[model samples]
Target: MSPVSSFLWTYAVGVKVLLSQLLSRSFSLPVFPLQNGKVAIVTGGAKGIGYETAKHLSRLGMHVIIAGNHENQGELSVSRIVKETGNEKVEFMYLELASMQSIQQFVQHFKAKNLLLHVLVNNGYIRWPVNQCSPGAAAVMLVPQRNTADGFEEHFGVNYLGHFMLTHLLLDTLKQSGSHDLNSRIVTVSSATHYIGELNLNDLQSRHNYSPHGAYAQSKLALVLFSYQLQQRLAAEGSHVTSNVVDPGVVNTDLYKHTSWLFKLCKWLTSWLLFKTSTQGASTVIYAAVSPDLEGAGGSYYVNGQKVKSADISYDEDLQRKLWAQSCNLVGNPERHQCAS
Candidate 1:
């Protein structure tokens, strides 16, 4: 997208978020009922909306694992949330989403504990500027390096594919944990930018032409597609698990730390008016996980604590299946049955 278009689209999204915040003034999700034995894994949960979501779940007596690559940040976040919520079950686990091997290790590590998982928040994300290296270091920062440790583009690799691999590996645990009353929840964080994304499945890696904006948008769109498809398969098999996607609205977070100085200045000046706080951004995610009304809800897009329609293209069954097959191939054939069955 052109700079003008990016700005306009961003502005429009900001306006919409602001309107929702104003109209819902004084609105807040009630404290979820205590969930003593439930377990949740929140990827990228070291900070921002992910951190807030973990903290909320912790306060409600759920065991919350904050998964991410940075050991120090992850540990510190665990300490802080545990301290604040007085929930001793909160802890940090290492999971690098940019590496499929790392994701596999994470699931293995979790399974070792012999615990059941009630919620999996695929919330870890890399910002848009992996291509932007420090001044005079552009040579080593070529586009291929922009691809993840695996060969996929970083946005798709970390943001979408890594989570895809994690979900498939853990689906059995999620199925076993869910019950007739409380379905297991798979929540993938997405964005409104997905609506403008033009996916070129023909060039999923953006090898011919690459743009950070387009790549990020495509990754998010792919996430929603995966989520909807996962729900469909689960429902067909008479499983108790549910999968859904969420757009947290524009929020002030580290996700914006890589943008240009001018963009940062504008955000700093207007964030209080236009942006959702990380806690507010996490509301819908927590709702999807524990809300009684949403126990069996699946294949839905959530915004601001409510269900809504996603882009029309996201509803395409053929497209969802095609992407799922391709993603399975990308991740490897060994794990296909985890999602397919």
Candidate 2:
């Protein structure tokens, strides 16, 4: 093995073992019943934990809209959910999580339906580096740097900003379904990596220096902060929408398929040693969505079906407000709109 590879394996093996142990004993999963006539929107519901969550929710009888980047995968997931749950209400919508324009288009399409949004799962993410353009898209000079069409770092743009904008656009429908008062939920799928993150408000985009893990952590932390901020704002304004965040723990999913050879080896070891099945990984998300414990709770972070303390930095109100303002501008939703009376 290469020197670096050997070193990573040596160090990561013990860490993985410990993670597995802690996760297994931390908390037990909860069960929830779905209210009939409710509707849910799950972004990235085509595969992995997102697919599992959508399936479970569909089984509970909610009309589900599976929003994802890959059209084929989305259709497949919808078909699978329908077959498994025997609910023909499950459907798919194409959403390119990397593009703000695509997010807007998605909202416009949903608006045409004029249905209330009972739950919104902000679950899609991108984890690997990309070249500036497709090798065949154009013959122009290639830029090696990474960025999204919205000009933000790719991880933050897709994982946080796209969902941020989508939620903003659908605020009215969400309010209509219910909120804290009637059990409406906005579940942000955060990560345990947030323990290693500190939101540098001055460098939210990570312009000067970037680490994929670092950027991912920052985005997840932002999601937590945004959830809390939204909860507080809604309560203060007497709106019913409740927001919460959850970590799925380490799961054996396709997310790591893009890792380098060295990293892939480490991922394999980690999966064998520490990872939970995708169903277990998605437990916390489902818990937040339909658990009776969460009936009236708003702005909380949960893991393994229990409330947990978020990193101290995730509680920065000043940064939360700034991030909220930045998100509104980025998403082009200046004022949050309520349902027409």
Taking all chains together, each candidate's TM-score versus the true structure is 0.90, 0.85
Q: How many pairs collide in each candidate, listed in order?
A: 0, 2
Q: What are the per-residue Cα lDDT tens digits for candidate 2 across 1-341?
A: 23344334433543554465556664556556666788999887877788888898898898899986666657877988998999999989878767888888899999898788889998745322234321121100111236778887776777788778788777777877885457678999987666655676677777755555556567777888888888888777776778999888766676654345666676666666566778877878888888877777888888777788988878888878887877776666633452110
lDDT per residue for candidate 1 within 51-113, as digits (tens), equals 899999999999999987667677888999988999999988888777788888888999999
State in Å the error of residue 85, model 2: 1.1
Instruction: Summing lDDT over every window of 10 consecutive residues in candidate 1, give the lowest-scoring window.
Output: 134-143
Q: Clashing residue pairs, candidate 1? A: none
Q: Where in model 2 is the C-alpha error above 4 Å?
A: 1-23, 26-28, 126-145, 179-181, 258-263, 334-341
Q: Compute the lDDT of residue 318 as modeled in candidate 2.
A: 82
Query: Model 1 Cα RMSD, Å?
Result: 4.2
lDDT of each: 0.79, 0.72
